[model samples]
Target: MARKRGREGRFVSTVEGAEFFKVYLPQFSSHQIRIPPDFTKNFRRALNEKVILKNKDGKTWYVEVKETPEGVFLKDGWPRFVDYHGLKVGEFLVFRYNGSYSFLVQIFGTNGCKKEKFGPQNIATHVKSEVESDNDDSSSVDRSKLFKRFEEEEEDNNNEFPKRPSFVSPPSRRKMLKIPEEVMNNENVHLEAEVNLRNAEGKEWPVNIYTMLNGPTFLGRGLCAFQRDNNVGPKDCCKFIFGNQTTIDVKILRH
Candidate 1:
């Protein structure tokens, strides 16, 4: 029998110059950055509780998800983490959530260089500044409205994630494949997951995996985004990891 799988989610954002440049921990209740609605909905942990943040190099940090009127933020270790990583404005940060409390953070330099680890050795010591309450300009974004939109959309659609197209036959017309009885007899599994596809250059690209019962077992979203960024093609093979807290690894055979 095949192994059971779990779900995954991701949120990629470019560091805004105004928001990420300076240490904002002093102004907030604890050091944290406002998280997206999807993040909060998926995790649903209580405010002021701790969550584990693992970096690409396997380093871990315990950070609290503090809920505020504006939204939720990752507090506690954020400032030191940011400083160590030398996080700069305009750099892209890819946050891959494991459909639970933990998140894997990958950093890309402004020039798209991959950074495996961030150490405090190279970073200058950050002196905690006086709490400047007025500097908290982030309060302008009304998170209640944003949260409402997500709630309404979830209620109306009843689908957690968006589904995209499945594997298509190439123009040459591939031969029909047979479905094994074991797979056919397997119970239907539908949930939010992710596929980590590696390009020719070996860069890890994560696409949203939406599983279904019929026709094809796995359908993926954000494939186009990965293709666009990585220039992947039908001839190139990829690897897929599916699950939430636990995961199963599979490979996509190229046509």
Candidate 2:
């Protein structure tokens, strides 16, 4: 006798599902979403307990699948899962059931606003690209492009940091100081390290550190998380320590 073949992973979000996500899903703290009954029954019948949902960018979340009177539903981390991917009301989510209890989700955003390529991996790639650009003598990497990459990785979507501000006079904030040339220019500092700026309270803030072929180094795009956290404004003293070749500690001396 022939063995029964397993169900394949193919599911598309309907208008109803999109409506459910935008209209009502955000209201609940449980962060559960009702899976379409027909799709679940036909394609996901084997989902007995829980499953791991992963997006195209490799963000994974463990979601509980509960079989209830209404239908099979995904709970626990559903809301934040969608939010992290910047899913909107009109967007469509395509699900492909990969084996090993995971679903590969592809997001179809509205008006061609693709947010999938801007993951943490891309951020690392962006920094690496700068390192590559350092090879050519005539071409100088655009600082704006670097900042744009940082903007893409920013958690605060509403207020993306602007390009580095130029202050005509002293302003009301603490400013970040540059790392010493000895350390920044070291042959060892190319792409082997990730510098962290630490506050007085010992909070570590990560920043992208890369060197150019010319004699210039940038801490991060415009104003990085460290600057925002302590209100590092214009002309304030910001001190940093090279904990090691891989990490650096920052101290906001004054605001």
Candidate 3:
């Protein structure tokens, strides 16, 4: 029997029961609802109860309070664990926690039939701030807005860590490659190298080289180059072409 109190059928309006007045029907009890976003609210209050959030380290935990931080996760499993792992810091985690006590946790990330490991480091998580109070007619939450908030928070956390050296990408045809010419100018640097590119059929084609690093810079700046006729680079002579081709091995020998 759906009642007008609490979450119980919240003010059913339509005779078919599919619709309601004020708010949707509550699956829980009369005055109790799901937990508030603040985390301090009683998650198990009224009809809804605790939420089980799966962390990236492979374990589930009931989050009664959520003030620790968003990306936070528990790893290696906590002894006498409160479920399993908790999202504490570092990586971006998918964070499989029930958005609301009334609804079961659903897949909300890039996972497509991919058994989620909870939260993934460096990847972003989506949290929807989209819940409107049943009693209130003016206010409502949107999921998209919540996701943006999560991204901003993630950036703040990552900025505090040391920057890692990013690998330079090989230039494609028509792209200019910048190489450190200054470093090469120093004869002591001594890096003798040559590359010959051939087609998959073993046909040698004239290749071109555009940008070479003049030298290494203190600001971590280096040089690169582009590809053209009469130029040869590593990407050209391969066992297979990218996208349509498979990975091929290359043997470099000193004559």
Candidate 2 yields a Cα-based lDDT of 0.48
What TM-score, to 2 decimals, does candidate 2 have? 0.36
Candidate 1 TM-score to native: 0.36
Question: CA lDDT of each candidate?
Answer: 0.44, 0.48, 0.26
For residues 53-156, what per-residue lDDT tens digits would candidate 3 score against the true structure?
Answer: 44332334333322233321222212212111112222122322243422223232323332343321111111111111211321243424533443454476
- RMSD of each candidate relative to the true structure: 23.2, 14.9, 26.3
Can you write out model 2's per-residue Cα lDDT over 1-255, one digit (the tens) per residue? 112345454342222222112223344323677766655544444454577777764656666777778777887556546544444466666666665556776666666554454222324444445434433421343435533444454445553323322111121121222344665655545332234556657777655443433434545432356677778654443434444544554434333
- Ranking by lDDT, best first? 2, 1, 3
Which candidate number maximizes lDDT? 2
lDDT of 1 by residue, 6-83 (tens): 223323222221112222233442246777675444445655677666678565556777777887778766654564
How accurate locally is residue 31 in candidate 3, as Cα lDDT from 0 to 100? 23
Q: What is the lDDT of candidate 1?
A: 0.44
